[model samples]
Target: MRTLKFLLQKEFRQIFRDPSILRIIFVMPAIQLIILPLAADYEVKNIKLAVVDNNHSDYSRQLVSKITSSGYFQLQHFGSSYKEALQEVEQDKADLILEIPSQFSKDIVKENEASLLLSVNAINGVKANLGAAYLRSIIQDFNRELRLRWIQFPRFNPEMNIETPSSNWYNVHLNYKFFMVPGILVVLVTMVGAFLTSLNIVKEKEIGTIEQINVTPIHKYHFILGKLIPFWVLGLVVLGIGLGIARVVYGIVPVGSYLTIFCFAAVYLLAVLGLGLLISTYTASQQQAMLLSFFMMMIFILLGGLYTSIDSMPPWAQAITKVNPVAYFIEVMRMVVLKGSGLADIKYHLLTVLGFAVVLNSWAVLSYRKRA
Candidate 1:
């Protein structure tokens, strides 16, 4: 225990003595947490819409008003002809074009049906699909409202219907920032912890400092713990800074207990920092450590369920996330923040990370060379 104590002191001193390491530990994650969440948002808004209103009747104008007032759409161009409206989409000014035929209003009133041409620019498929769907929903609502108003008059048959009102739970307004910020915080903290720890040992070797340590009576696991403990604490500190930014700047407060988050984070740091140490044990230089770290970081982020749903992935990719430490933490962050899930709720994930910590740190300790 005394040996471990002196070793930790040396590691912390080395970390604080270097200005570059200090910035990488404290400033880098804080800055990235502030910026990345805003950029990583997925909610598509401000869909540019073009309208070609050949009917020019009260019903047609009312339909246009319904669309623009829904807050999902912005009327970029209003044209008298479909060709002009199509030009708006062709020029990339509009994502969708709604064309009303010459007798559209007349047909809707007299025949209860009208033809509507929707031209969508499929360049950005997600935007095009979602924008078109929103427009169609707005038009359908307008049609229902028209039917309700028409029924108010002396119509022979009247039908009453039951409507199911739905509410959006967790995120009441479907705020994408609410979902993204926590996951970004996880990634930022993980990257800082893993990358710096990976580079630290490799740098020591490059400068011939590691040889001095290897010649000592200090046990191998003692050296590994000395390296792991400081960065594990810093990882938690980064998590704290991220949560503060999430609260003060983004207005995100985790509904779950802070204890649960910290508990998961403490175990999570072990797994992440252990993985870094494992890499450091195998590599001879900082360049090789960096290359390997980058490769692993890419795999962790891509499969981490940050932007994509794991359920939607193939069975093979889904199986890979079982071993991806980043995926587990990101999933836990969202669950605790969005669902108010407690430690009991994430027990399976906790155990998985614990297993990772034991395996990785043990591997790192065994892999380290004690002799020249």
Candidate 2:
């Protein structure tokens, strides 16, 4: 117990004395939490649109007005030439082009049908697909409006329309920040816990201080606990900072209890810190540990359902997420914050991460050598 206390004191003093470490622990998470949610938005907007108006008719003009007014698109170019509109797309000035045929209004009136051409810049597939879908929906609504205007109703009977209204659960405003902030927070916290711990032992080795520690009558478990506990506490501190930013900057408060968040975070940090300690045990230097940590972090975050849905991934990729600790934590954060999930709800995730903590920390302790 006395030996572990001394080790803890030394680790904390070492951490606080280094200005670079202090900046990384406090400053980096703050900036990333504020900036990442704003930039990592999934809702596509401000899609540039080009139009070729061959009919010059009221219906064609109304169609163009409806599309621009829908708020998803911007009118970048409006001219009478398809060739010019295509050139705008080629030059990257337009994301998509809307071409109305010369007989657009006449065909709709006389034949009750009309053809429209859409030329899309497929370089950005998501924007193009969403833009085309938005345009099509507006055009369909316009078609329905025209039909309603021209149709004659009998006095004895009236047409009845069925409407379906949708309610957005959890995120009433559909704010992307609500969805992204928690995940970004997890990533920042993970980076801190993993990268910092991974480099710890390696740095001591490089500075020739490790030899002094190894000569002492210290138990390996005590040494591991000393290294793990301080960073584990710091990891929770980082999580608190991120949650504060989430509340202050984005107005997001977790629907679930703060106790729940902290409890889960405590265990999650053990797993993450253990992974870092494992890396530290294997690597001989800080540079190698950093490169390896970055590589592993990339795999964890990318498959962890931060920016993309794990369900949408291929069967094999989805299988990979089951083993990923980051994926479980991100899912648990969203569940607790947005859905007001209880500890009972997250038992699966908690147990999975706890298992991770046990395996990783055991491996790190066993692999760490007092001599050699």
Candidate 3:
């Protein structure tokens, strides 16, 4: 107990002695939690739109006004030709192109139908699809309004009775920031535990202190614990700050138990710290540890449903994410925080993260050598 206390004191002192490290430990997490959530929003807004109106009619002008008035679109340019509209989109100045045919008004009057050409950039497939869907719905509503005014002898008014009732669960407003903030917090915490601890251990090796520690009476488990506990606490502190910001600044509050979320976070931190220890065991230099940790972090974040849904991924890719502790942690965090899920709802994620913690810690302890 005395030895453990001494080691813990020493570890804390070392961490605080370095101002840069302390700043990184405390400041970086908060910055990332605040900034990344704002940047990673998936909600499509202020989408630049270009219109090529060849009809020059009142109907075409009304359509343009409707498209612009919809909050989803911002009219940037009026192109005279399809080529110019396409150029505006291709040059990244516009996200969508609305082309009204030359005989749009005549076609609608004679044939009772007119086609409007809508070209959307498909690079971000989901956003593009959503934008296109919004545009189509607006057009459909306009056409329905036209039919109601033009065709007065309507029997039963079939179109008016046909309604598509839509309700979004968990997130009624569909705020992408609310969906992403919790997940981003998980990623940021994971990064700190995985990257910082690994580098700290490797730094000891580079500075020739690892050999000195190996010769001491300090137990290996105690040494590793002393090194890791501070980081685990720091990660949790970061999680708390992030949650506060999410609630206060973003107006996102978890409907579930905060204790339950913290408990899972504790388990997740163990897995992340274990991974860091494993990396430190293999790396002789801080640079190597940092690089390896960064590469692994990228892979885990990408596979962990940070930017995309895992359900939408391929079967093989989803299977691969099962081994990733980040994936389980993020899944459980979002479920509990956003969905108001209970313990029963996240049993698999909890168990999976617990298993990872045990396996990774065992591996890290076993792989660490007394002498390099």
Candidate 4:
């Protein structure tokens, strides 16, 4: 116990004395959490639209006005021919094209039915889908208004229409940052924790201190715990800074218990720190440890479902995520922070992360040789 305490004291003093380490632990994460969510947001908006009004009728103009004023679309072009409007989409100036055929108003007034052609630039598939869907919704709303005014005798019997009201749980306003911040924050924590710990023993080896430590009376577990505890605490501190940034800059506060977040963070750091320590045991220098850790972190975060949905991934990729610690932490962070999930809600993840922590630290400890 006494030896471990002294080792921890030594590690912390070395950590605080190094300005570069301080920057990775504090400055980098603070700035990134503040900035990443802003740029990585997934909520698509400002879809450019080209309207081709062959009839130039009042109803066609009204439909265009409804679409443009709905805030989802911007009027990029209003051309006389479908060819010109299609050109706008081909040039990438427009994401969607709305073409009203000849006698559009005449058809609606005389036969109570009209048709319009809609074309989308499927280059950016998600943007195209969402933009087309938004335009369709606005056109549907306008058609309902037109029905209310033109034919008062009930077009389809309103009493029989099925209206589904959807509630966006966790993110009521659909704020992209609210969805992204927690996941990005997890990456920040994982990178800082893993990179630093992985480099710790390697740095010692680089500076010719590993020889001295190995010849001493310290146990391998003591050395491992000494290296692990400092960065583990620093990881939590970084999380604290990140949470503050999430609140002050982005107006995001966790709906779940802070205790829950902290507890999961503590255990997650164990896995990350252990992975780093294991890498350190194999590498001979800081540069090698850093490069290897970077490569591993990239793979982990990419598969961690931060930018994409894991369910949408290939079945093989989805299976891989089952063993990915980063994926579990990302899930737990979203579950607890956004959904206000209790321990019961994340028991599977909690147990999974616990398994990771146990296996990784034990592996790290065993991988370290007392006499090498």
Question: TM-score per candidate, in order?
Answer: 0.94, 0.98, 0.93, 0.92
Worst 10-residue lDDT window, candidate 1: 152-161
Superposition-based RMSD of candidate 4 using all C-alpha atoms, in angstroms: 2.3
lDDT tens string, model 2, 23-49?
999899999899888888788899999
Task: Please provide, for model 1 over 33-92, each residue's C-alpha lDDT reduced to its tens digit, 9 standing for 90 to 100.
Answer: 888877876767899999998999998998999899999999999988888888888889
Which candidate, 1 or 2, has the higher lDDT?
A: 2
- Please identify which of the two predictions, 2 or 4, would achieve the higher lDDT against the true structure: 2
lDDT against true structure, model 3: 0.86
Q: Against the hidden true structure, what lDDT does model 4 obtain?
A: 0.89
Selected candidate, larger lDDT, 2 vs 3: 2
TM-score of 3: 0.93
lDDT scores of the candidates, listed in order: 0.89, 0.93, 0.86, 0.89
Give model 4's clash tally. 0
- Among residues 3 or more apart in sequence or in different chains, the pairs in candidate 2 whose N, CA or C atoms overlap within 3 Å are none
Predicted candidate 4 versus true structure: per-residue lDDT over 1-372, tens digit per residue: 999999999999999999988987899899888777878957678999898889988898888888888888889999788888888878889899898998899999999899989998998999988888888888889998887677644555544546799999788988888889999999999999999999999988888888999999999999999999999998999999898889899898899999899988898899889999999999988889989999999989999999999999999999989888999999898998888998888888878888888998899889998787
Select the stronger candidate by TM-score from 1 and 4. Answer: 1
Best model per lDDT: 2
Off by over 4 Å in 3: 121-128, 152-160
